[model samples]
Target: MDHEKVNILLVDDQPAKLLAYEVILKDLGENLVIASSGREALEVLLKTEIAVILVDVCMPELDGFELAAMIREHPRFQKTAMIFISAIQVSDIDRLRGYEMGAVDYVPVPVVPEVLRAKIKVFAELYRKTRELERLNQELEDRVRARTAELENSTAKLRESEQRRSMAIAAGKMGSWDWDWITGDWMWDEGQYRILGVSPESFEVNPANVQALLHPDDVDQLRKAIAEFNSGTRSYETEFRIVRPDGEVRWCVGTAAATVDHSSRVVRVSGVTVDITERKRAEEQQNLLAREVDHRAKNALALAQSIVRLTRADEVKAYVNAVEGRINALARVHTILSLSSWQGAELSKLIDEELAPYSPSGQIRLAGPEVQLLPTTAQTLALALHELFTNSAKYGALSTRSGRLMIGWQVDDELLTLTWEETGGPLVRTPKSRGFGTRSLLASVESQLGGQAKFDWRAEGLLCRLEVPLTRKPAATAPSKFDAAAAAELQRASG
Candidate 1:
């Protein structure tokens, strides 16, 4: 697309032939350089770049073959297209030699004007494309270099600003202290006494006096750090607890660097101390909450997947009803747990939520101790209770206005056992098939809560019992324990 001028070199020993070659190619509208001999053509080539060369094979001295061979030796002309034109009919051997010497085409003259024009036109277009590509590539490199330099400048300025900020924080918030290695004299900035929770006149500024105020648990570690610094470690840093005169304990981190004399003797030790008890407490709380959230999220997702897998119905509406009911049951338990900061949920509160719908008819009654259930246990039991409630409302005792339901639980040692009883409705009969709700209730009790379940199909009503652990172990934090195979199966099923 670039309309840059391209050169076509024409070489011949005869003036008449050169004139005729010029006349044939002038209509192409490109630069045409003419030379009387091969030597003159080589001289012209040395001064300017050309796209194609048309040379006479029978030129005086420096023949076409010899010139082409010489041109091929130059790195710049390696890809330049060359065509050899001979006045007399050339033999096959001469034509082969011209090709071996880098000739792209050979023509016997009386040359065909159209053939020469087409060949020169192809090379001229190729040269123009090559130049355009080179220009684009150079521009891309320049942009990359400029952007890289800009990033480096930004990074350097950021590092400078960070250094200044760190210096300012150290000066403003920390207590600077120094000790002389030779005289054993101690120095304290006004901030150091405030950090120690003592008036300047009340305490001596000496290593022994300071060590006396350190908590017993931290004294040995602090002493070791000081010993290491005095023995040529060049620096000291350690965190320790100190007890003030009022018996209040505070956590402090101390840092010191040693300066040595030219004679290789320690000269001075200097550094700062700052309180970080609040930061450490905050970090601990954050880690605990993070672990709790991760555990709850994973368990909730697994529960949903299980519910979807276990629920079965012939119609879409039936399946949707079953899944939504179970999810709402889980949400009811979560609402109670969220109120308690996820510590534990009261058994009475959990029962009220699951049985709230049936309580208006006076058919549902709950009696239990003031037991606190862990978050996981509360969720699993809530789902199980909802399934039982649904069955009673449909086919069991609660279907009739006079029917009665009683739930009770008691704790013994490490286990808590619950009993559910029904009466005053149509006679209970053992069903031929166990539905999804029955299986899900049993599975939630046994597998998720690490509990056991039993059912009795008495003629008066249906009776059920469940036993679960009271204190559940906290969830693990490491990701390696997250079962990848189970997650993959869940993903496949969802897909």
Candidate 2:
């Protein structure tokens, strides 16, 4: 049988090294993923399943050994193969440490392409075989279970009374029941009693007793199904809920058939009941996830719409640039939130990413404690920061080579206070009137986030302060009608 391809991850800070590995592994016909740093490798591992990981031994932040240890810590990747690539001669102690950290093998510097390819191919094939074996084992187990069930059913049909009852005990979650209309008699096997959460000694096998165990809402449904069966229906299937003796409500599916005499009149009914509570719970969880995705998608579209409708510029190019910049900021926050499973995003990371374009100049500094912001808060704050950065780049501190910007924040009593101060720039003067950029920044913090924003036009540059509540409830997915009205008023004021 042909096996499906597996994934192989290559980690190195050097782009050249990653390219060389890619070239060597191309013939393996496996999915090859490259990460330029340990953090990037972790991110890839979060979203992809890898059979083999080839990591450089001397990368900064997180080396091969550290990465191996972290990967091994996760239950899903515990058995994944890790190979360390070292440029220099590794000491015996270093090799030992690597092995302890879950490294399966080591390739020295100036690797032979053929040797590297061979090693990766072996591991990739092994991973595929292992997965195939697991699948086959599961199939064999399923077939065995099906065969056993068939044999037990056949035995139940061939035998009567005591022998049939013995077979029902071995059917696990399934239980057998029989009812005779002529004698008004009902029979339940040991498994039936177990399913009802009762004992034969305490509970009698009678119609009224069984009806009492059925959930109130499902009683009418079961009655309707019985009525249909009595009207010449040979076999019928139905799902219902039963409230056990211990007050636990369990979902069950029953398959039943009618037995008739020569006159074509129903004489008896027999059926099997199986617990289906776990399946129902799983379906509920899936529905919840789908709703969450829908909610997030609507929120994203609404934010995009607001950006387009509210943005103002004099020239067409300037308008497109402004809209694209705001949209990109929204996209960046979305990426950050997705990486975290949409739970939230770190405040420091959001700021760093928004200001990354000017980071290389070494004039921007960020100081703050680790703070996580909700998705709505992060999205609005990202747009506000983008506007601030754009204005600074065009005419503020960032417009000059000698200028410096400091971003600092502190949290106290469930509130975060952040300050953005600029120095060493051209002389600053307060604007004669509010523009769209200023209005947008204020609206993002005040209207959308329910936060506070204060700006002071100092002689040196702009100094802004922001205060946000950390314990606020999540905002609505789309902006409210009031937000639109406010946007219109702001636009008129700016004009």
Q: Identify the leading candidate in terms of TM-score.
A: 2
**What is the C-alpha lDDT profile of model 1 across 133-166, one tens digit per residue?**
9999999999999999999999999999988756
The list of candidate 2 runs beyond 4 A from truth reads 1-173, 187-191, 485-492
Residue-pair clashes per candidate: 0, 0
lDDT of 1 at 3: 85
Model 2 over residues 362-471: C-alpha lDDT tens digits?
Answer: 88988989999988888888888888898898888899899999999999998889999999888999988777878877876776677889999999899999998878
Which candidate achieves the best lDDT against the true structure?
2
Q: Candidate 2, residue 313: CA error in Å?
A: 1.6
TM-score of 1: 0.48
Cα lDDT of candidate 1 equals: 0.82
